[model samples]
Target: MRVHIATDHAGLDLSRYLVEELVAAGYDLVDHGPAEYDALDDYPAFCISAARAVREDREAGLDSLGIVLGGSGNGEQIAANKVRGIRAALAWNLDTARLARQHNDAQVAAVGGRQHPREEALEIVKAFLAEPFSGEERHARRIGQVAEYEATGTVAGRLEELRPREFPAAREA
Candidate 1:
């Protein structure tokens, strides 16, 4: 997989560490970077660039993902998700990381550099990279709803269409 990564000054060291570690693990990496630590730098440009690369690469039929890091990861996640088709998730642990991919099929993961130790953060990223989305019908349907809403600004009659005709009876087998 091609991994595109970016971070602001707050996450510079962790970003460097992740690049080195992920590269050594045989994954192709693209660093959309600040290049040097600048305290006044903004996260939106870097995070959005990485997210856009992931979107473009995937659209071009390449397997790609993105990582955006910052002190708390909140702003970075928000920035990445601003891209129309990108699903960015804030993942703080192994389960959250894995579920981000499995449940949401998120293309971008936002990690808080200050939230975990470097090794732990690495583990979280690894979990995210390894989990495949569970392509269950409900999951696909929900993702479709989100995509539809994103493109059309409304889900319209989707809820009505998907509603169960009647609740299952409360009977014991």
Candidate 2:
């Protein structure tokens, strides 16, 4: 599988480590990176690039995924999700990592560099990479709803029907 990775200065070391480790593990890797630490570097540019790569690769029928990292990973996750057709999940533990893939079929995972030790973070990434989407009917239905809403501005069912209409003008007091 192809894995794209990106991060700001906060996660530079971790990102580099992951790149080397993942490459050694035989995964095709793309590093959309700062290339050097800069305290003022922004996460959005790199994370969005990585996310876009994943989306484009998938659209081309390639098996690909992404990882965005930062000090807390919160901003990185938000940035990645801004890309169309990208489902980015913040994973702090092994279970969350696994579930992000198994349940949501997320294309990108966000990890916090300052939140855990390097080994634990590596384990979390491993779990994320190893788990496969369950492909259950319920999960597929839910993912489809999200994808539909993303493509269009609306979703089906009650939410669509309940869209608020403009209120009639009230009589002047």
Candidate 3:
């Protein structure tokens, strides 16, 4: 797999560690700038660059993924998701990380440099990298719904189409 990694100054150390781990694990690693950390350097530049590379490869029907990191990972995730084809997930634990790929087929994982310890973060990354999309019909359908929403900025009727055929106008509660 071609894995692209991008991180701001806050995540420089962790990002360096990940590059080493990824290489030892035998994956092609792409570093998307921020080679030298600068406190004034922006996060979106690296995150979006990584996302763009991954998105471009997917456009050509190639397999690719990305990891974007920042202090809290929120802005990084937000920026990565701006790429139309990028499904970036902010993963906090093993379950969320694995499920991000398994259910959402996420191409990019947004990890928080300050959220978890080094060991836990490593585990989360490993879990995310290891899991494969489940491809169950329901999961695919749900993912499609979300992707459509992201692309068009509007929810599809397919979702409302699945609502209960009949229901009381008012909630029982």
lDDT of 2: 0.94
| lDDT of candidate 3 at residue 90, scale 0 to 100 | 97
Could you give candidate 3's per-residue lDDT for residues 116-148 as a string of tens digits? 887778888888888899999999998877877
Whole-model lDDT values for every prediction: 0.95, 0.94, 0.89
Colliding pairs, model 2: none
What lDDT tens digits, residue by residue, belong to model 2 across residues 1-173? 99999999999999999998989989999999989999999999999999999999999999999999999999999999999989999999999999999999999999999998888988999899889999999999999989898998768774657857799999999
Candidate 1, residues 1-173, lDDT tens digits: the string is 99999999999999999999999999999999989999999999999999999999999999999999999999999999999899999999999999999989999999999998999999999999888999988888888889999998879796557756778889997
**Candidate 3, residue 158: lDDT:** 65
Which scores greater on lDDT, model 2 or model 3? 2
TM for every model, in the order presented, reads: 0.91, 0.91, 0.87
| Reference-based lDDT, residue 77, model 2 | 98
* Stretches of candidate 3 exceeding 4 Å from the true structure: 158-173
Name model 1 segments beyond 4 Å from true. 158-173
Error of 3 at 111 (Å): 0.8
